[model samples]
Target: MNELKISILGTGDMGGAIATALSRRTRHSLRLRGAQPGSTSALRLIDALGVTEASKEDFLASDIVFVVVPAASIEEAAAFLNGYQGIVVAVSVSGSVGRDGLPSSAERIATALPEATVVSAFTSIWSNVIREPGTSGKTSVFVSSDDDNAKEVVSRLATELGFEPINGGALSMALYAEVMGMFAVRLAMDSGYGRTISFHAFNAG
Candidate 1:
């Protein structure tokens, strides 16, 4: 894919890490939108990283949108792109969601904005792993979307970000994908592996 106009909501840790990695990897135009666009970190990204602050119209006009906010803010992020008709990739995890819940963070966002083509991806790995170029090991990113075309777009982006993207089936499968991510987190926290480790899938040939 050529230059894509991308809009990212939320400017916290994961958002900042993604922006940093993407800025280094792709020259695609990026716009940061959130409750605090004029904050210190936002200004740094705007001035130092060449990221622009986008308005509601600008956010809606972008080719692809990424919702990087927390699980609790999924509804607000959906409201941010209420009538948008483009692809939305939700990287945030549905932390409090129970096992087998249909509405994961990505699913909930899709539900809130029924018109949007939302894909669940980039959640099962750490931001640090995404920043690397896969020299050591590749992190497997699970992608779930009802729209095959949108899923393809996100898969390409994942490859560009140095991850091995795996199809997690239809949008409903996003529930399982997110649960897997949470399980990885639990493993890291409980097993003393720390956040540096990632969950990966191997293809048996």
Candidate 2:
């Protein structure tokens, strides 16, 4: 497992969890920066992970870029990364549906940053579920992207993080995956399954 250079752009719940997960893996060189770089939470995460503040170049230089911010900040994240040419995995659901009724975070991000190969991934799986990607666990990480190459790239990253990444195929399917992600969270909330639950694909074969 050669070291993969990765950078996380945010220190919110999702971002912090992701940085912690990556830090626990010795095969990664992780750098992180927060939208509010000097905030209490960001500083705490930085200190805890021993990750220095990242620069614009650091964010862009990584083999993968994780947009692990809150759901509300998806559009803003896209706007901030408008011109970046890289593979971006949206780890947040980015809200249920836009007023137009077909707004997925991945799609909105693509619309905002046309140059980037944006992929909707890790959005369905909660941070808690990933923190301990259990051995012999059935949990899975779903990924959607128009570019097959980018999709494969993210899938490998997911594997490194101890997740079984399922290729949902074509960016259009991201809507359904997003819906599934929302449904999973709501199910956990209502069914008492808690945040640690993640979906697994059982082969019918």
Model 2 residue 108 distance off true place after TM-score fit, in angstroms: 0.7
Assess candidate 2 and give its TM-score to the true structure.
Answer: 0.90
- lDDT score of residue 12 within candidate 1: 74
Expressed as tens digits, the lDDT of each residue in 100-149 for candidate 2 is 48678778778877888888887778778767776657577788998998
Measured on C-alpha atoms, candidate 1 has an lDDT of 0.81
The alpha-carbon lDDT assigned to residue 160 of candidate 2 equals 83
Query: Who wins the TM-score comparison?
Result: 1
Worst 10 residues of 2 by lDDT: 91-100
C-alpha TM-scores of all predictions: 0.92, 0.90
RMSD of 1: 1.8
Error of 2 at 22 (Å): 1.2
> Where does model 2 exceed 4 Å of error?
98-100
Inter-residue clash pairs, candidate 2: none
